[model samples]
Target: MSKYFKKADLILFIIILALSVLGFILLRKPASDNAQIEISIGGEVTEVHNLDTDAEYIIETEHGYNTIQVKSGQVRVISADCPNKDCLNFGAISKEGQIILCLPHKLAVRIIGGEEGLDAVSY
Candidate 1:
């Protein structure tokens, strides 16, 4: 405790830090085992695949082409004919809500969480 930071200040700081950590633990979305990948072209959803499957897809748009791969519960853009090649740098995404976008080809790959099935209360 210093002139500026008294015991009260230290207690308040510790309380705030504890609350922050608790909030993150309670609010963060957990990775879902039943996640799936959704592919979109020109803003329209084109395909949906299960994360448990391994596959590759070559999407050809009017502007160019992009090669995407899904392997071992993760999906990424492997190659593309786009001029910038920025999409390839986005790397792989496995968690729900993660997305990889190829602007030049109007292609987007996104991971979505589990299906909305009937819960215990609904039965």
Candidate 2:
């Protein structure tokens, strides 16, 4: 057992683990400040709302309607008339680049304009 297990080997394993954790934390993107929600329908910019203000907005499209709520610096779809209602399951988003889409209604709500990250990704 001593031949296979050494103190140096244990120290090296711990060092590798610590470095991995640190790398993960440093590489992860942080949430943005002064974020705002952008609402678009049919590729047209309809409206934008600040996350800091608490309000409710109803977006009416040719297909249907969606109710959006902004409160406590977070935005979410409180209710919608879409068939799937998938937007409601998105909960709340306060981070930049986060989006909630209602495909059936052609509605797209996204958080933008604060501490933007890398615009493109390379494999």
Candidate 3:
């Protein structure tokens, strides 16, 4: 019984170490110069934008309103009518896989990278 407990302890330690390494890896976001933006409304994709161009966009819905701006290779929510204004406070995001959400209006904005994983159809 004691031998079994020792093996279990060793296995648990290895699992913890692996998880710590993975967490550290995940913390370091990959740098991306140019990326595509995918914005969704009410759980459906509504718009796609690129970070290479400078532009300003306004999103208005019955639930709320938000203003998004892209400039100099980054995107951010400048202003919004959401109660908490969480999106505006989120500042700018330029890295892939970063996301900005306006929960009150059910809006989601995400950065799409060039190196994507296999699609469902491919698998």
lDDT by candidate, in order shown: 0.84, 0.83, 0.80
Model 3 lDDT, full chain set:
0.80
lDDT-wise, the better of 1 and 3 is: 1
Residue 8 of model 2, lDDT score: 89
Best by lDDT: 1
How far residue 118's Cα lies from its native spot in candidate 2, in Å, is 21
| Rank order (by lDDT, best first) | 1, 2, 3
Q: Predictions ranked by TM-score, top down?
A: 1, 3, 2
- List candidate 1 stretches off by more than 4 Å: 1-30, 118-123
Worst 10 residues of 3 by lDDT: 113-122
Q: Mind giving the per-residue lDDT tens digits that candidate 2 earns over 1-123? A: 387988989999999999988876664334456577899998888998877889999998789899999988788999999999999988988776677888898889888765355344322
Regions of candidate 2 where Cα sits further than 4 Å from its true position: 1-31, 114-123
* TM-score versus the correct structure, for each prediction: 0.70, 0.66, 0.69
After TM-score superposition, what is the CA distance of residue 102 in candidate 1 from its true location, in Å?
0.5
Candidate 3 is scored at a TM of 0.69
Q: For all the candidates, what are their Cα RMSDs to the real structure?
A: 6.2, 9.9, 7.4
**Model 1: lDDT of residue 100:** 91
User: Ten residues in a row with the worst lDDT in model 2?
Assistant: 114-123
Best by TM-score: 1
